[model samples]
Target chain A: MAFATKRLGKELTKLHGSLPPGIELVSAEGFEEWLLDIKVLDANPLYLNQTYRLKFKFSPSYPIEPPEVTFVNTKDRPIPMHPHIYSNGIICLDLLGSQGWTPIQNVESICMSLQSMLTGNTKNERPEGDQLFVANNRRRPRDIDFYYHDNTV
Target chain B: MVNAEQPPDPVRALEFKEKGNKCFQAGDYQGAEGFYTQAISHDPTNPLLYTNRAMALLKLSHYESVISDSLTALSLHPNNMKAHFQLAQAQIALHHEKDALESAKKAYELCMEEVMHGGKGATSLGPIMELVRRCRKEVWEGRERERTRTEKGLLGELVRDLEDRRDVEVQRLEGESAGEIQIEEVRQEYEGKIESLRGVFHRAGEVPRRRVPDWCIDDITFAVMDDPVVTKTGQSYDRSSIMEHLKRSPTDPLTREPLHVSDLRPNLALREACEEFLEENGWAVDW
Candidate 1:
């Protein structure tokens, strides 16, 4: 109840208000995890009018540390095709990574950043080694050794 | 301390001056100095501006800066009692006895004239009069030592004047600040009455006692625990709840890190905090 549930409770209360466009909170039933839906507003042909779901797994460190954020592919949600996104829905964005995350960036900002990332992208393919990494990778998204040489995304 | 980034606007400068006043009232002398500097830059000719900044500098114990600001204020408006009083105070603080005596005498004379004219300068008159008496005593003592070495006559008239001034100053200061003491006493009495009313309401069960924040409680049991333990990742849980989780899985319930029963350290600080909270709020045990 210290950092995990207490912080998530406040975040959940904030998410109930009107959010920025294209980022909608789907479910936040518990303090551990939350599901959010984000859409690229502009007519980017790769993700034109397509909605994507993001799954956020928050550790107890929470805002002091970054929440674990990745795309969740379900029956209704599909992972957007980007060079940074893997086929298994793991995104390799630096903001979700350890080195680039800041405590001030909240759930809504993360969703908007993801939405903007998709909107500005022109690529229709996943990361270069999507299939190989998706098949063998068992590490958590935070633990993954992501090479963030690509800043254009 | 003036922020050079914003373009100069007198209206904005006034706003900043008001902000400086608020900061001064809140005892943020450094912040008030910064704001006052900004205000002075926008309205440089205002004598009161320098006087206001001098007050903040005085509280910060910047004796030299206060003296400089008070000099500037006095140069612009020679009749300013505040700047004179502040100059006297700063000089005295810096142990410039002769200069302090001169400034205090001038301030006391001006303050007395203002008070005689039915002006609102009585608030400052009392303190300036006290400073005058102190400075005169210091100067007299310094001269008396020199006179003792030179075998000069003792100034009996000056000593009589000091005693007369002491009695008159004491009577006047008591009369003025007496109203303030009475108001303070009445305010304290009303505050006590209000506190008793609140206690009566509590006994009648009209108002509930305060509750602890959810963060301080155990998530599983939903109670304040005496023995709390923190995980390596910094999430604290009740010892019993975490022990039950550890028996099923050797990982933390939240972080899923490779935690063992041996890794769970007793949170001594949180345990003491919980005990203190319970001591004040015994009702929270049931809550």
Candidate 2:
């Protein structure tokens, strides 16, 4: 797990050089956490001209274990509305889950996956029980075992 | 009258050491070396001055000077881990693989002892371990090179022996009825044997020409694999990294299947390929 920092350092260097379109690194001051701003490149009306900020929190076992990823709300930035995304900024993508993560996935790849996830969505609404989950669920994103039944998005 | 044997001025030495440290922190190796040299002159018995100068010399790539300074430092302070580590780095730069390994091992032992005693330098164990790993890799590469050389020499001798036997057979058949045909057959047989032997040791002649190949890298650590093992899904990872992952989660990293440690098989051929690559390109360990 000590080698996780080394891997993250390499990923940071690569990100500094170039990243895919619609993804820009915001801050990566340390190995513990990073922030990146992402936008939907396509003119999807649901997320048109809107930029979302992503927060990546890495544990010591990152890359082996998935990093905890969520959207952060700011004054100017709003959480994207999708059936799989809650108002609380927690995403329901399987790729971010422990079962779906692989060491081959890095920060850049995750950003791209999120960008595509947002771009492909057509529902202008949150998950059905978004308010209940946001208000009552005190568990972290990784701890909450959300049933991933909706695969359409 | 100026006395040639003046007693060491500890105060001046401390001042010079402070200057040297500042220079080192400022990334001015030349300035650091100059200051450390002055500090050593003021206090010739101080091992820290010599070790400081050794570090500056190492940064300057004056590997020979670094070795001498580090040796002096070690002679003054036998338990100095920094001196041993610096000596190892200098030895490795000069391609003294065996001596480098010994120095690195000494540093590692000192680091571990310090940690066990709850010393302040316990945090230095990580860097010492890294140096030990590098030195071990260097020593392994050196032995591999020696083995390859010996094998090539033996193969050359075997080929020469075959040529001599072919010549003797041709000489014995000289002026006989079918002497020319028999001589041609003998030559062809010897040539074929030599060619096959050459093919066997062909890899020995290769010079390191490229960066580490992707096959030698473990996706888990993103570093060159020392001991690679194959999972049930046919993907390979470094043994230690995969084992660490299995300790926390008993599943294949890539496939997400329920994988136990017992399912891993040592990828011996891949390991050998990686060894050969590292033997030629020793820098791949860091890669």
Candidate 3:
């Protein structure tokens, strides 16, 4: 029987049609399973127009498991901001991790989610108190006691 | 005499990897897992094979097997960051937060170092960054939640192990004692521990909105909350319960293929409901 990587590549190739223009996945290697180059279509009011590249790696368990995603571009290409995103590109969303990972998930679905994760975001607000908060201390969007009031980002 | 140095038949291997990926995408982690195992058997030297297999195991929630696969991969290629990443995932699943954190840091450091030396670093950051954040959040801060859960889990395992050991010992003693009543007493002792350990897990979630349980597979919630019919012979449970049981361990009920939520499907109605739910909930839903 074949393994998960070949299947992922085939599925990803099939996804070329649905994927956003700026967000194209480059070649996936053994170490890096997913390579996404995102061209931010709409400029953020705070950071102005800037594009960024994102990367992803899936465990053999792709859809049934959440993929391992990260930001690859240097700080020169600033990442977008939202309540769950850290200055370091660490996303605090519940969808990607165990708190939110579902078995029905896949690469196309994750990319679509991330696209919306970026598109829906407008406030450019970093995780609360971004200036001082380290990656670990910032309360997860799921753990935060605060009721989610804003839908932006 | 034929010239050597042709890249081995990566086609079948590639196909195996693809099948594994398909199973994974379908949420059949167990199925994906078997495919990965087969893929690796076909191409035993590919570090990616182990990394992928380890991940499938993690999705199946088989942290022990995950750890083993990652360690094996790492042993083959010490500099392989994906191996480290998979190891970290297994560690996180096992609630070894400190180990997982360290493993992640090592993976990040290695990836950075590799790229600095003109090596292929995070050529793709989209998924990796998502995982980095997730690991940082879940493994770093989730340590507290994970520790509590781990302790209970360890306790449960200890009792189960002890019970099995005692059962064997007691059977041997019964043979020697020739129907002595002492076997009953020994059995009771082991049973008590198992009972108490189970109690701990039961009490763990008593707190309101307590940390998500480690044993709970978050991915299958959609199927569970949607249609839950009990299976008569454990052949296939209502999608949810079966998924839950599989999350506990993906032993195929029939063939033990390491099942996942993907291996099963909902009727068109349930499937439609899932899609509608994702849309309404604003979940990142895709085909």
Candidate 4:
């Protein structure tokens, strides 16, 4: 836990210096959780002129483990419609999954991946089982065993 | 020593220790120091009280007092990590670089021992390791300073020796047939030699621009590698970081292939390069 926090501290200092375009840090008040705001730079009709808020939760064994990332709904923010994104803000990306995650991935890299995932999407509908999963699912994003079969956006 | 007239009051000491902790958390180091002093008076045998006082004194930059209090705490409990850490901090502040490095290494060793035993102080290893690195850097800089001084003194002696030889040659040439020209040539030769030696020393004394090379940094820990090991994929990482990773997951962090701790080979060449870089730029430990 201390090692994770120290590494996060270094990452935070680097983030303060500069972040990639289309990705902005919302808040990083502690090592436990951070919020980031990302936007699709190109004029994708589905995600045009919209901002998405991402929440990242770090476990004690972070870097070795992937962060729990999910979208959050607010008054001004809405969950973007995508085939892999549910109405409840849960995302189905292999990069977020334990098997697909590697220590080399970082917060900024995650944000960029999400940004590109949004940019490449043409479908404006949620996952087929979105409504049911949103209603019945009680587990966190990291714990859910998502089968990553879909490669096309 | 306890006032033998009145028995030690452990309960009062606990109360005062709580007060000291509260004050220390609130950033009132003076108040914290006072409370810890009272706590120590109540329980003279408790090393925790002295450590608390030392921590407060450290915050207040009362380095000498911090050293004394930390020493007292260590005397009470020789393996107290906090006491050793504080003593190292105070020693570093006082520019006792060698002593600070020794104390910091002691703390780091104790932390590692605790980790090996599955004890309670595993969380403290990160900070203790960082302190050890800082102390090592300080000690290195101290030695560099001493080496520079010795080099300067040696350069002075060499220059004087050349000048003395030139004077003797000129004195001998004064009685020769072509005395003036030979004397001038002897002086010019010695002066050129002295100038070249000074140039060499000047270049040696110049401080190298501080930059940690990418090859020396471990991608896993994002730190300058002290002990680097090569993975099967040709990537290198700090040995401790890779071992820790292998403990949790038996896959290469980069290539995601099935990997084992036994698969790692010491990157002897890269390790030597990192060590050589650190010898000149010890501050890269923080990098």
Chain B structural similarity (TM-score) per candidate: 0.48, 0.67, 0.40, 0.78
Global lDDT scores for all candidate models: 0.75, 0.84, 0.59, 0.86
lDDT of 2 by residue, B104-192 (tens): 87987787567445465645755765776688687877877788889878988998998899888787777465667777998898889
Show model 1 residue runs off by greater than 4 Å. B1-287
Q: Model 3 scores what on Cα lDDT? A: 0.59
By summed lDDT, the worst window of 10 consecutive residues in model 4 chain B runs over: B114-123
Candidate 3: list runs displaced more than 4 Å.
A1-3, A16-18, A43-48, A131-153, B1-287
Q: Write the per-residue lDDT of candidate 1 for residues B1-287, one digit (tens) a residue.
A: 33477545678778879999999999999999999998988877688889999999999999999999999999889988889889989998887877997898688668756754657665575466557646655655565456554432223444445456555655675777767666555556545655665465446544355657766776544556655788888878876556545544566656556778668777888878876675455555535
Q: What tens digits encode model 3's per-residue C-alpha lDDT throughout A66-104?
A: 566666656556666667666766666656765455444
Candidate 3 lDDT over B1-287, as tens digits, reads: 11154344557777989999999998999899888877776677777888888888887788898888888888889887887877787787676766876787677657656643546554422244334434545543454466667877787678778878998989799779845568887878878877877786768745343222212212332212223222232332334334434554564443445555445644545434543443233222221
Candidate closest to the true structure, highest lDDT: 4
- Cα interface RMSD of each candidate: 10.5, 1.7, 10.3, 1.5
Among the numbered candidates, top TM-score falls to: 4
Residue by residue across B1-287, what tens digits does model 4's lDDT show? Answer: 78877689989999999999999999999999999988888899999999999999999999999999999988989999889989999999999988998898788768766755667775576667777778878878888889989999999999999999988888777856555777788899999999999999999888877666788877776778766889889999986678677777788988889988678888999988987887778767774
Model 2 TM-score is 0.55
Off by more than 4 A, model 4: A1-99, A105-147, A150-153, B175-179, B202-217, B226-283
Residue B177, candidate 1: C-alpha displacement in angstroms: 60
For every model in order, what is the number of clashing pairs?
0, 0, 42, 0
In terms of lDDT, the poorest run of 10 residues in model 3 chain A is: A140-149
Candidate 2 overall lDDT versus native: 0.84
TM-score of chain A of each: 0.95, 0.97, 0.70, 0.97
